[model samples]
Target chain A: MNTLQLDLGERSYPIHIGANLLAQPDLYKKHLKGSLTAVVTNETVAPLYADRVVKTLESLGQKVKLIVLPDGEVFKTWEVLQKIFDGLLECSADRKATLVALGGGVIGDMTGFAAACYMRGIRFIQVPTTLLSQVDSSVGGKTGINHPLGKNMVGAFYQPQAVIADLDTLKTLPPKELAAGLAEVIKHGAIADAEFLTWIENNQNALNACDPKAMEHAVRRSCEIKSQVVAQDEKEGGLRAILNFGHTFGHAIEAGMGYGQWLHGEAVGCGMVLAADLSVRVGLLSEADASRLKKITAALRLPTVPPKLGINRYMELMSVDKKAEGGEVRYILLDGFGRAKIQAVDDALVIQTLQAAGAG
Target chain B: MNTLQLDLGERSYPIHIGANLLAQPDLYKKHLKGSLTAVVTNETVAPLYADRVVKTLESLGQKVKLIVLPDGEVFKTWEVLQKIFDGLLECSADRKATLVALGGGVIGDMTGFAAACYMRGIRFIQVPTTLLSQVDSSVGGKTGINHPLGKNMVGAFYQPQAVIADLDTLKTLPPKELAAGLAEVIKHGAIADAEFLTWIENNQNALNACDPKAMEHAVRRSCEIKSQVVAQDEKEGGLRAILNFGHTFGHAIEAGMGYGQWLHGEAVGCGMVLAADLSVRVGLLSEADASRLKKITAALRLPTVPPKLGINRYMELMSVDKKAEGGEVRYILLDGFGRAKIQAVDDALVIQTLQAAGAG
Candidate 1:
């Protein structure tokens, strides 16, 4: 098993990466706090792994409660987040109980947020079952539900006790979901690690085929970059804003497409392409580098062409994004091959990039 | 103007206590961040002081927006919390925008929780109008909405940039509300300040008459005791539990009687009496001291007798309280004149106390 630790002072936690790591009771036992544990998962992933987790916890004499929510990005709302609370309250889950988020990004985000607010905060563990969550959401303490006005507009930056990413769970991921996960993997490389970007470009076929070694490498590299960024700036005051490279435009895309229609990763994939296009138009990134970024996105079967959501609609949606400030949407654009920075671009130029990226 | 600072390390903020504090543009400007500010108040407070706050901000050259929610504790739900987000989104409030929570405890809590979760947290200032909020909720960083199952069950420990407690607003407060605020004032004395308890007893007539000098002293002292306790234990790990001296039973009363049926302070007033009875029964507190506490509560015109919600029902509701652990309801009982601690008492003793307190 490969392990990476996010050194966030008192909030520091570990990420365990390996196949069949879920069956390891020691990993689950070492991190959890208090007496009782609530494993929060979604319907799609619950039937697959919830029982296994419950059995493991119960076998260890840990009082375990389960809350299975409906799957899909659409379910990531305050109403759905309430279900986790209701379940915990019904089961008499106390201050000492730890919540184990046991699904993909949506589950991790919602469960992590629930932990953050439960009794003004409780211990939670991340059992991210998808590559998207394992590399991205699982590492950062950012957890929240989507608002109707924008995606992830309401949430908290609450860390987990630990993160366990069992590669075996990837076996059940559909091809579309796998490709969606690649969007975030591609983002980690595009924003900070050029060598990792090249590795992803070189191992496109293996990654697309879900090769174990390639997947492990990709997840590890992505987590290392995210953990470093988060450790330096946990609250996203400065440097952490760069991690949201494709998120500003991606959130617009997700909101415009009416959430769940376009996967978060898919929106981010297209968003990275548009941000790259904006970077090139603004003369920040070279056309060759921009094309290379788009090339990798396309190679992984992720959407490079953004849906033709009207430019006005896109601008309207993007303006409400978390990244937007004082009526200006700040775009995270690549300054060089592997470096990115937050910049507020001219509206006309942003519109031009939106038009061009949509037409691509 | 009287000022008490809550020294919570980096999260520390100042609580300004005085008459006409809302008119002070500098106090509002000094603490608020960003270019735009959204002032969140309620329908009741809107006509009273919302315009004055807006005028103050506008005169300071700060672009201001307003969102007026329905008043009362019943309105402190996820549905109402969403309206603040809707208003912020409609006006394009960003991460840089400051949310000025301008109302009572309900408004302070919901608005603070909104600011805490808005864009994964943002800067917020508390403009507390009610006595309960000005002395308690406004100072502490406890912000959140309520679930149907519980009060403050869903929330965050996000502190505000500053708190402005304008005593002039109390002029318009109903007599019942003023008495309710004394419950918390009484709690502060019971838990941490013996001299303050005597002061409250001596100044009951002045407090009931809403004497300005007496009110200021009460508010200031309550905040000082609370600030000291919170500074030592922000997350209620140990010392902070004493701050919730009457809250465990108070929350149960509030939940059992139906939210907003009786004021939070009213429930707590009776809850303190019940806790005292339990302390006496457990031999931790003398009957004379318990009766003295009850007499003070009675003299203040606050409820000393609790409604007879079935013992089983009370236990069920109290078990879900944030203070409860492993299905054991930990009661915060006063051990002596000015000391309180969390103790999980025998079920039979708890039931006996409930029966006697309800009968009283």
Candidate 2:
């Protein structure tokens, strides 16, 4: 087991990395301080893990209630949030009832959001099931549902009481999803740590083989980088924009294709490739570095190009991305591997990058 | 003008309390740094103040867009919050657009929530008109809306860029609404400063007659007390709950009677009376002190006895209050005016207190 703590003063929370950590009942017991613990999961996760978690919570003298929601990002909406509230009321959970989010990014995001809204705010634990959630979404406490017009359009920067990412759960995730999760792991390297990028490139086979130590290192390093970024810019005031390295274009792709059509990390993976290519065009990144980024991502089986959505539709969709500054579309282009900067690029350049990235 | 600062480091904002502050275009122009500003108001405040504030923002080379929403507390829903997003989208409001909340608490809460959710967050200014908003709601930055099952079920503790509380607007307020707002003003005295309570008691007639100095002192002292409390406990971890001295009972009244049936301040006025009566039952307050609270609230023409809701309905409603911890319905009991403490009394004692308050 490996442990990393995000030092955010009172907002600080610990991230635990290890195999079978979920089976450690103490992790569940420690974070949930209330008498009642509500488990929020999607249809997929509940059948597999909810009972075990509930039994653990019950053994700790806590009453457990389960709210099993529909799976997928498309279900992330105000109506779904309302359902969670209904469950809370029906179960008679109070302000002290701890909400435990138990699934990957979709479930984690929706549950974190549900906890954020439930009773104005309540204690919640993130028990991420997917690799993407374990590496990225589960740790930082940014929770929200998507508005019809935009992705993550309505949410709060609410930190969870604790995060427990059990690597054992990843064994159950599909290969495609695992590849998607690795995209974020690679993102952490490209944006802030060239050494980590090299390490990922060297250990891609081991990571694909589910080597425990290698996987834990990837998760811990990604969390450490994100923790530092989040601590400095908890509310996305400035430095936090770097965390959206591929998200500006990624969100546009996701929204353009409609949510649930592509995995978040997969879209982000393609967006990063295009972003790197654009950086090369703009002279901030070397073609060699861009090639290195692609070779490593390919080893993980993640997509390196956006699906064929026409450039005009893509541009219009991305224009509303929260990452855009002052109505101008921007990208978190790399200055080189391990260094990134936000740049306002012209439409012509973005269209050109799209053409190159989408070219066969 | 009286200025009180919240002192929350970078989140700190000044509460400007005085007559004609909002009418001055310079006040709006000085704080708004960018050219794009969106004034989010409701139907009630649009015809009343939006045009005037828009003219001021426009005069300062700002492109102003008015998002006029439907009025009422019940309208403070996610649906309405989405409308603000829609309006921003319609206006093509980029990150540079500053949201100016130009109305009472509902508008401020909704606008702040929208800003907090818009692109993760945007700069917002609170132009609080009602005394309830000016003295308490505007300063705290606890922005959210009610749920069908619970009040303020979803929200965030988002601070504003600035707060402009113009006292002159109170002149046109309906007598009932104005008196209701004074409930919060009186509450600050009861929870934080005995001297302020005495001052309010001594200047009852002058305050009723709209003495500018009395209003100034009332607003400043109230803001200062709240500022100190909020500084210590940004979230309701501890001291901030003292600010809810009357809120537990007030929330029950609002929920029991259905939201908007009784104005928020009116319910809080009654809640304060019930809470004071509860204090006597719990052995923290003397009967004499309790009577004085009723007298003071009555002097301000605020409701003293909580409205008749059957004991069962009150219990059902109060149990769901965000303050209820571990199924224990705790009330903020007052030892006397300007001194309050949270206490868990037996259900029997709560019933007796309500009966006594209703009779008194």
Candidate 3:
């Protein structure tokens, strides 16, 4: 087991990574300092692991409540958030109550957002059940639900007290979902760590097989990289946007296809390929390097071609994405595998990419 | 104009208190860095001040969008927030869009919450039209909506870029509403400043007459004191909880009777009176001090006693207030007129207060 601490002074917290960390009762009991606990999960993950989490928390004599939301990205709404509030209120959860987000990115984001708004704010933990959540969303403190109009439109930058990423939980995740998560890991490598990218290429199969050590290392490294970035720029004022290496196009794809049609990470994987292709077009990425990127993503069974469904839909959806600043489209472009910068790409580039996706 | 700054680093902004601050076109123009400006106001204030504000902002060559929400606390809900989002999308307002909260607490809170959620937040300025909003809710970054289950159950602590408290708007406010706002001013005196308390006592009647200079001093002093406290505890982590003086019981009075039935300040006025009496019982205040408090509140035409309502209803509403930490029911107890502290008061005290309200 390896652990990394996000040193944000008072808001600083620890992230634990191991295959069986879920069984370590102390991981939750020691860090969770409250009278009541609400473990928020989704319908999909609940049948598999909810009982294990509840039993562990209950053994510590912490009053626990379970709130099971619908299992998809589209279900993240104000109505669903109300169910979380109802669970807390019905259980008499107080301001000191600790919320545990016990599933993947959807569950974690909605639960953390609930904690942020429940009683105006409360303590919460991330018990992420998927690779994408463990590596990316859970640690950054960006919690929100999608507006029918846009994704992550309503939220707060509320940091969690701790993150418990149990790799054992990822054993049940389908290979397609697993491949989707690799998009973020590949993003980490593409934006800042060429060595990590090389390593991921070498160990791609090990991760797909859910090898405990390799999966744990990837989540830990991704968290370490993310924590360092967030500690410096908690609000995406700068540097942190690099974390959105594939997210600009990814959000457009997600919204254009409708939120749940394509899982966030699935869109991101295909979007990364498009962004890399675009980077090459702009003379920042080498064609050879882009091919290597495509080979690795394809090997993992992740999408590598630009999706054709959302070419015209891009303008409307991308307009409201968080990445858009000053009414202009800002893309996180790669200068190389380990260097990325936010750039205002011309409409010609965007149109060409959409055309490429349409023809593909 | 006397200005007070809530110095929250990047989130910090100025609170300008005086007559004609609204007419100063520079106030809106300075923060209008981006191309789009969306002004949110309620129906009541729009016909009077909307054109003037729009004129000023438009003269600066910024694209302007105006959204008028129904004017009342009942309208402060997700439904109204959706309307704001719809308006923003209809006008193609994007991330760089600046949201100007162009009304009182309801408009400001709903607008701020909308801004906080619109593209994960944008620049917002509080144009507080009433005394309650200008002196209190406007300064804090706390923005949210009432839930059927509870008041302010969903929200975000999003700070504004600036707070414009144009006292000129107070001239249009009703006498009863104006008196309701005085409760907050009296609260500022009760919790922190001894001399300010003395000043309010001496000139309470003059303030009732709408003396602009006295109103300026009151608003400026209240903000300065709140600014200092907020700087120390931005999230009600500790000292900031003291700002909720009378709010615990006050929230109950408002929510129990249904919000806006008793104005926020009116409920707080009565809540303060009860708190002072309870403070005497708790040995933190003298009988004379309690009596003096009641006399002053009554002189300002504020309620000295909560409405004779159902006791159980009050209890249920109070439990749902976001301030009840750990289910222990923390209360903001006044040590006297110029100092306050947060303490876990006995449930017996809360029950007694509810019983008293029922019998009043």
Candidate 4:
């Protein structure tokens, strides 16, 4: 077992990476505050892990309530959120109760948001099952539902008490989702750690094969990078914006292609390519390093070309991206291979990048 | 003008109590972060004050967008919140843009919650028009929408940059709503300030008449007491529960009678009577003090008798109160005339108090 801590003062919590972690009591039980615990999972994940999770909590004498939401990014809506509320209220779960999110990013985001809003706020644990979630979303306290007009448009920065990433669950994950998760791992390296990027390049075959040792290293390093960034800029005042390196363009792809059409990681994987292209055009990054980043994403079997949504459609969607200010979209471009900076690109330059990076 | 600051470290903000505050650009404009601002008001308040608010911000070179929601407590829902998001997205308002909630408690709460969730978080200002909001909701960072299953079941504790409470807006407030606002004032006095309680008792007629001087004193004093309590316990971990002296029972009243059927203040007024009765039964308060509290609420023309929601219904509703833990309903009752404590009363004892205080 390997552990990494996200130091957030009073809000600090640990992320545990290991196989069969859910079967281990100490990882989750240490964070449990009250006797009442609600396990919020989606339908797909519920059939697989809900029983083990409930059994573990019940063994610790917790009165457990299971709230199973429908699966998918589309289910991440206000109506589904209300269902979580309904379960909490129906079971009379109070402010003292703990909510355990027992699925991937969707469940983690929804449950973290549910905890933030449930009775103003409550304690919750993140048990991220997907690689994407374990590496990124679950670490930073960014939990919210997507607005129809945009992705992750509604949410809160409510941190969890702890994060339990049981690698055993990854065994059941579809290959496509696993590869999608690597997009974020690649992002962490691209934005902050050049050494980690080289390490990823060396271990690409090991990662593609889903070797436990390689997976553990990728997850831990990614979380360490994220935790350091979040500890400094908890609410994205300035430094935290760097973490959204590919997200602005990624969000446009997610919204433009219709949410759920492309997995978040896939969109982000392609978005990073465009951001790199824009970086080279703006003279912020070298053409060699930009292509290296693109080559690595392609090697991971992630999308290297963005879908050709009309430049105007993409512009309309990106205009509503949270990173935009006063209607001008701010792009997070690489200063080099491992450093990121937020800059406003010229409209003409962005259009050129769009034209150059689009799939035929 | 009277000002009180709720000291929450960096999240601290000032509460300005005066007449014609909206016309003063320095009060709000100084806190404005970006050139774009969205003024969120309800229908009832829009025709009355939206133009002045927009003009005030416009005077300071802010490009403003006005979003008018239907006026009423019932309109505080996710669907209406979508309207606020729609307006911001439609105009492409970004993270730096400001959201100014320009109505009573409902508008303040909905807009504050929207600002808290929009793009994960953004800067917002409170321009409270109703006396209820001026004294209570606007000062604290508590903002949310009511769920069908529970009131304030979904929300966040996102503080505003500043709160501008213009007493001048109360001149147009309906008589019934003004009295409802007084209920909170009376509560502040009863729970924390015996002297303020005595003052409310002596000045009932002036308060009932909506005298500007009396209104200013009541609003300022209430905010002072609330700000002090919130500064110590911002998230209600302990001492702050005392602030909800009548809210446990009050939430039941609001949920028992369909929301908006009984104005929040009216229900809280009557709930205080029931809570006082329970406190007397528990031997924490004197019968004489309890009756005195009831007499003042009655004197203000607020309800002294709670509607006859069956004991079972009240118990069912109160069990879901945020104060409750592990299915035990915790009531905030007066320990004497001005002190409060949270304790779990026996269900039978609560039933007895309900039978004694209900309208016959």
Candidate 5:
């Protein structure tokens, strides 16, 4: 078992990664504030791991309630987020009642946000059941629902009590979902660690096969890089903008196609490719480095090309992104491997890159 | 103008209380991050002060968009709150865009919560027009919308950049609303300042007539006491709970009668009366002091009696309150004048108090 602590002062929490940690009841006992606990998951994960978690909480004498929301990124909206509130209120969950998020990024985001808002605020644990969530969403305290205008447009930077990433759950993940998770894993490597990117390129087969050892390193390294950046800038004031390297373009893809059309990591994967192209145009990166990043993304089975959302549509979508300041979309470009920069480029340059990528 | 600072470390902000402060552009300029600013008000306040605020922002070279929501507490729901988001999105408000809450408590809350959640968070200024908002809601960082299940069931504790409490706006306030605002002014005196309570008791005429000097002192002192308590415990971990002196019972009455039926301060006024009765029953206060508090509440023309909701219904309502822990309702009882205590009392005693008040 490997544990990493995300240092956020009083809001800091531990991230537990290992095999079958969900079956270990002790990981949850310390975080439970009261007798009542609500395990919030989606329909898909509920059928698989809900009972194991419920029995574990109940063994410790907790009155556990299972709230199963519909699964998918499309369900990440205020209307659907209200269901979690409804379930909690129906059971009379109080300020001290703990919520355990037991699914992927969508579930973790919604439950964490629900915890942030329920009675002003409450405690919640992130029990991520997917690779994308374990590596990205679980570590950061960013919890929120998306609006029709943009992805993750409404939410809070609320930290969790702890994040339990049970590797055993990844054994059942579909190949496509595994690829989506790899996108973020690649992002961590591309922006912060050059050697890690090389390692990913060399270990494509091991990752695709979901080898326990390789998966563990991937998740750990990804969390380490992401947590360090988050620790420095908890609220995305300045330094944290680097963490949104491909998000400006990624969010456009997600919103332009309507959420759920492309998995978040998938859109982010292709968005990275577009961002690298923009990096080359802006004289920040060599074409060879951009090509290398693209090759690595494609080798992992994630999409390397964005959908044909058109120049105007993509620009419109990106302008509403949270990273945009004063209506000017700021692009997070790769200055070089292991380094990133955020700046606003000319719209003409952005359009040229989009046209080259066939997205214009 | 009288300026008081709420010391919340990095999140600290100034509360400016005086006549015609809203028309002063300098107050808004220092806080605004960018050119775009959204003025969020309700229908009632828009016709009264929206133009003045917008003109002020426009004069400072701000591109202002006015978002008018429906008036009343009933509209303090997520559904109605969405309108603010819609307005912001329609205008392409970016991360640096500022939101000015230009009404009473409802506008301040929804706008503050909107600012808290919009793109994770944004900047907002509170221009409280109502006396109740000027004295209470604008000072604290508590921002949220209500649910069918409870008042403020979902929201965030987001601080505003500044709170502009214009005494001039109170001139247009209705007599009942003025009395409602007095409830909180009276509460600050009862729970934290016995001298202020005595002053309130002696100056009912000036307060009733909305005299500038009396109103200024009332709002300034309330902000001082509330900000001090908030500075010690911003998230209500312990010391801040005392600030909710009558909120537990008050929320029950508001929810029991359906929101918007009784103005929040009116319900709080009556709830304070019930809490005083409970304090007497628990041997925490003398019957004479309790009667004195009730007399002061009634003298301000605020309701001193709770509606007959029956003991069971009141219990049900209070249990779901944010103060409740693990299904047990924690009552904020008066320790004596100018002090408060939180504890779980026997259900039988609560029932007896309710019966005695003719609310059973």
Candidate 6:
């Protein structure tokens, strides 16, 4: 078992990664403060792992309640998030009750948000089942439901008690979702570690085949890079903007295409391509490096071509993004192979790139 | 104007108490970080003060958007809170946008919670028009909407950039609302300042008449007491629970009667009476002191009798209160004239107190 700690002072928690860690009651016992525990998972994950987690908690004398939400990104909304609250309230879950989120990114995001708001704040644990969640969403405390206008438009920076990522869960991930998770894994390397990017390039087959050893490295390295960035700027005042390297364009594509049409990671994967192209146009990166990043993105079976959203619509979606300040959409561009920068570029230049990329 | 700083380290903010402070653009100017500002008020307050506030912000070069929600606590639900989000998104309000809560407690709470969740978090200033909000909700940063099951069941402890309490606004308040505000004033004196309690007892006529000087002192003193408690324990881990002095029983009355039937402070006023009775039963407070507190509550024209919601119903409602931990309802009892203690008492003893208070 490998454990990584996200250092957020009092809010800091551990990330446990290994095989069948869900069966280990000790990981949960250390964090839970109350006898009542609510396991919040979606329908897809509940049928698979809810029993294991419920039995483990019940064994420790916890009064367990299973709340199963519908599975999908489209289900991430205020109406659906309220179900978790209803379930908790119906059972008279108090401030001391603990919530264990057992699902992928959608479940983790909604559960973390519910924990942040339920009783004005309570303790929650993240048990991310999908590769995308294990590598990215589960590590950072960013949890919220999406508005119809934008993705992740309403949320909180609430950290979790701990994150348990069992590699065995990845054995069941669909190929598309696996590739979506790789988009974030690739992002960690593309923005922070050149050597890790090269390693990913060298081990394409190993990652594609879902090898345990390769999956472990990808999750660990991605978490290490993310935790370091988050520890410095938990609220994203400045330095943390680099972590949203492809998110500015990715959010635009996701919102423009209507969320759930393209997975977040898939949108981010293609977003990295556009961001790289913009970075080259703005004289921040060489054409060679841009192409290299694109090749690597495509190598992971992720989409590289931009969606067919027109420039005006794309610009409208990007302007409403949370990253935009004072109506100016800030683009996260690659400064080099392993570095990123946040700045606002001219509309003409952005549109030119969008047109060239077939997004116009 | 009198200014008191709530020392919350980096999250610290100033509370300004005086007449006509809301019309002063400089107060708003110093805290606003962006050009776009949203003034969130309710229908009752909009026609009265919305134009003045919008003109103030506009005078300071801010493009103000007015979001008017339905008045009353019954509207303090997720469905109503969504209107604020809709207004912000419609205008493309960004992370840097400032939200000015321009009404009483409900507006302050919903706007503050909206600011806390909008784009993960943003800045907001509290322009409390009601005395209850000016003295209590605006200072502590406890913001949230009510769940169907309970009042304030879901929310966040998000502080505002500044609290602007205009004493002049109190002149327009109805007689019933003025008395409701006095309940919190009396509570501030009872829990933290015996001298203030004595002063309130002696100056009932001035408070009841809405005298500017008396209201100023009451607002300023209450902010001082609440801010000091919040600074020590911002998240209600321990000492902060004492600040909820009468809230446990008060919430029960509010929920049992259905919200909006009794103004929050009115319910709190009556709750204090029952809590004092319980404190006397527990031997923590003298019967003489408890009677004195009840006399002061009644002198302000606030109700001292709790509605007859049988003991079982009261127990059921209080158990689901945000203050309850692991199904144990922790009651905040008066330790003496100027202090409070939090503990779980025997249910039978509590029932006796409720029965004596005409609540059973």
lDDT of each: 0.89, 0.84, 0.84, 0.90, 0.92, 0.92
> After superposition, which runs of candidate 4 have C-alpha atoms over 4 Å from their true positions?
none
- Can you write out model 3's per-residue Cα lDDT over B214-273, one digit (the tens) per residue? 888888898998899998888878899888888878887887788879888898999988
A-chain TM-score of every model? 0.98, 0.97, 0.96, 0.98, 0.99, 0.99
Runs of candidate 5 with Cα error greater than 4 angstroms are none
Per-residue lDDT over A1-360 for candidate 6, one digit per residue giving the tens place of the 0 to 100 score: 999999988888999999999989999999999899999998889889999999999999999999999999999999999999999999999888999999999999999999999988999999999999999999889999998888888999999999999999999999999999999999999898989999999998899899999999999999999999999999999878888888888998988888899999999999999899999999999999999989999999999998898899988888888888877888888888678788999988889788989998
What would the per-residue lDDT of candidate 4 be over residues B1-360, giving only the tens digit for each residue?
988888999999988999889989999877999898999998899999999999999999999999999988898998999999999888877888899999999999999999999988889999999989988989889999998888988889889999999999999999889988999998999889999999999999999999999999999999999999999999888888888878888888898889899899898888899899999999999999999999999999898888888888888888877888766778888888778888888888888998887632
For lDDT, candidate 4 versus 6, the one ahead is: 6
Displacement of the residue A108 alpha carbon in candidate 6, Å? 0.9
TM-score of every candidate: 0.98, 0.94, 0.95, 0.98, 0.98, 0.98
What stretches of model 3 exceed 4 Å from their correct place? B349-360
Q: B1-360, model 6: which lDDT tens digit per residue?
A: 999999999899989999888789989998989899999999999999999999999999999999989999999999999899999999999888999999999999999999999999999999999999989988888999999899998999999999999999999999889888888888888888999998998899999999888898999999999999999999999999887888889999999999999999999999899999999999999999999989989889999999999999998888888888877888999889888889999898789988998888
lDDT of 2 by residue, A217-311 (tens): 88889989998898888877778888888887788888988999988988888888888888998999999999889888888998887878888
Q: List ranges where model 2 is wrong by over 4 Å.
A: A202-206, A209-214, B211-213, B357-360
Output the better candidate (3/5) by TM-score: 5
List residue ranges in candidate 1 displaced over 4 A: none
Two-way DockQ contest, 3 vs 5, winner:
5
Off by over 4 Å in 6: none
Each model's fnat? 0.91, 0.71, 0.77, 0.94, 0.95, 0.92
DockQ of each: 0.82, 0.58, 0.66, 0.83, 0.86, 0.86
lDDT measured at residue B166 in model 6 versus the true structure, 0 to 100: 92
lDDT of model 4 at position B23:
86
